[model samples]
Target: MPEFAISADPIFGTYALWVGTLLAIAGVILFVLGTLLKRDVSQVWLTYRGWLIMIPTLFGTVMLGRTASVLGVAALSVVSFKEFARATGLYKDWWHTCTVYLGIAGLAIATLLPDPTTGANGWHGLFRTMPVYVIALLMIIPVIRNKTDGQLQQVSLSIVGFAYMGWMFGHLGFLANSPHFHGYVAYLIFAVEINDIAAFTFGKAFGKHQLRSNVSPSKTVEGALGALAVAMALPWVLHFSFPHFGTTELILTGLIVGIGGQLGDLTLSFIKRDLGVKDMGQSIPGHGGFLDRVDSLIIVGPLFFHMDRWFHGI
Candidate 1:
């Protein structure tokens, strides 16, 4: 009888790799679909499908826990920030937007540093570095004050632009740096995406009561409940299949991630509503822009990271 040899690598690694690959392929498909469907389909549908593709790609890449993942996120963040800034008219002064990009690049570099003991430390370093650089850049604003009538508005916009886009997106690096950060990327993506899908599916199927019509017309009470149901269900599945997270931990995580994801979506919607713009930008074809694609992730990342740290000791 011939002896059989088994691979040393566990099945989990193979599964994760497959998941990541599939996500990347799906992103490409969606991008193509968005391009081809531009005139034939409604922006809403295009945007929906586009996001369905892009989120998974980012989620999968982040899960790989490589330098490329960090760079990928930083690049996405910069594009999204630019889109939001442009839409809000906050970047009318091109210099402010440039300054923001500079700050984001600096933060990204700091986050990529070889070793950090804690996620919180990475965040602290990023937060500390950004303000100092931004402040130095802002000092130049007074000299350029003659260009704009309202000096305060320019200053305020600069600060808000950096804080909203750069700071929020930087949290991903922090999350990636966590001790048990190994699985966090997938966890965050699953929680946020599932919540969105549940809400949308339920709202379309059984949404009678409105949650916030003015801000986001499609959202409804039924949808919210549906999202909550899916959110709660995630723990049950994870508990038995993945020993890494206990039942109690999963339950807490699901709630925080679910709620935060929904909040992120609504908050971005509010911004779009205020700006009277249909989409953030045309970068992602149907998705509008990178910001639109990652809105929920932005909100959920920090909350989940901190919550997991507190609860799971990650």
Candidate 2:
């Protein structure tokens, strides 16, 4: 692996410049169109502005170094977990929420530390075992408080929050330690976001059949298929992102982003639908919240991580 420098990988810089240029052009075009038509582009601007900040922050942190990249991802995971906790009412119980936070922090720390056995940058052994320790601590919380009433719900919620939002999502951060850190992380994030946009575009254009009316009313089968088609073609289009990926790996990568990404989104949708909440929180203007924005990554991270690790030992 090359040293973690801003220009260590030309692909990274290329993507940053490309995405920045596209965002700039899109923003200007949208503004001009809105002005010409005398229409309200507030919502569109809000989303565009969010992307403007997020794109740079992402590129800057990842380019800083492996440590910075890992920490940035860990921070995002913590915020995401906070949103989940708040949405599920687990935030009211400081004991449960705090323990999960500690667990997430531990996962981040483990990712930062070198593997004791092989002296590798990240200790995969300890990182994978963190949930066991976290769950055990969550179970011990009730005993320490000497309260059994309502402990089950709190404990269950805490466990789910930490396991799903923290550790699983933290897999993306762990990938920073991989040899192809820049390519892998950047490709996954970019591909997943494009998958989201493709779904919305296709849905609006030719959507007549609802995918799951109960979970996400606006989602359509046509949109889902269109997103899948785009995702499946992305690997070939941007094969530079993973030049090492052969035919099988490329196919699997597409499937993971296409199917796994939507699954992650729907999983959060399931939670929101069950809780009867439209949005998780109002943290972001047009994005709803951190959890809402990163819901697609929750499942995709772990699935891609394991797949890459299994095939290439990354």
Q: What's the lDDT for all of these models?
A: 0.70, 0.90
Off by over 4 Å in 1: 1-60, 114-140, 143-148, 240-242, 312-314
Model 1 residue 90 distance off true place after TM-score fit, in angstroms = 2.7
TM-score of 2: 0.97
* TM-scores, all models, native as reference: 0.77, 0.97
Cα error of candidate 2 at position 30, Å: 2.4
lDDT of 2 by residue, 27-95 (tens): 889888788877888888888888888889889898887888888988888888888888888889998
| Model 2 lDDT, full chain set | 0.90
Supply candidate 2's per-residue lDDT for 312. Answer: 88
lDDT of 1 at 162: 75
